[model samples]
Target: MKVNYDAQNDVLKISLSSTPVRNCDFDKPGVVLGYGSDGSLVDLEIREASRKIDNPRSVDLAMNGRSVHGVRLL
Candidate 1:
């Protein structure tokens, strides 16, 4: 999985699969869901992250109940 934030575009993307995106649909006004050719979810994108998120510049993620720094994870 990979996460990327484009400050210039104010977009935040969270990619869960490496599969090529074959289609995309807006789940909501500024939220888009990407799908692979197999119809599985590939990634998610949030537009205007600053307006939709409290702190667009900050990201705290945890996987498997643990964090990368071995500290608290949200």
Candidate 2:
């Protein structure tokens, strides 16, 4: 998995897989979902990310109920 934020565009992209996207759908305003040919979720895109998230350039990740990583600033 990979997360990237384009501050210039205020857009955030989260890539869940490397699969080729077959189609894209707008799940809601300013949000898009990409699906693979097999109908599995491939990635997600959020427009106007700065307004949606508290801090669009930073992220906190956790796994197995533990803070396994430090915050990352894009």
Candidate 3:
């Protein structure tokens, strides 16, 4: 999984899997959902992320009960 944020566009993208997206849907005005060929959710995109999230620049990850804070791509 990977998360990326585009500060200039105020967009945040979270990839849930390595599957290639075959189609995309507008979940809402500022949200989009990506689906793979099999129609399984593959990723998510949020526009105007800064206004939607408390701190758009930060990321917190959790897996199997373990959590990580202050994660960034670089």
Best by TM-score: 2
Query: After TM-score superposition, what is the CA distance of residue 39 in candidate 3 from its true location, in Å?
Result: 0.3
TM-scores vs. true structure, each candidate: 0.80, 0.89, 0.85
lDDT of 2 by residue, 2-51 (tens): 89999999999999999999999985999999999999999999999999
The digit string of per-residue lDDT tens for model 3 on 1-74 reads 88888998999999999999999998589999999999999999999998998887888888899999977644
Give lDDT: candidate 3, residue 21.
97
lDDT of 1 by residue, 1-74 (tens): 87777888999898998999999997589999999999999999999987887766666667899765422212
Candidate 3 residue runs with Cα over 4 Å from true position? none
* Candidate 1: stretches off by over 4 Å: 67-74
Clashes per prediction? 0, 0, 0
**Model 1: what TM-score?**
0.80
Every candidate's CA RMSD: 4.0, 1.5, 1.5
Candidate 2 RMSD to the correct structure: 1.5
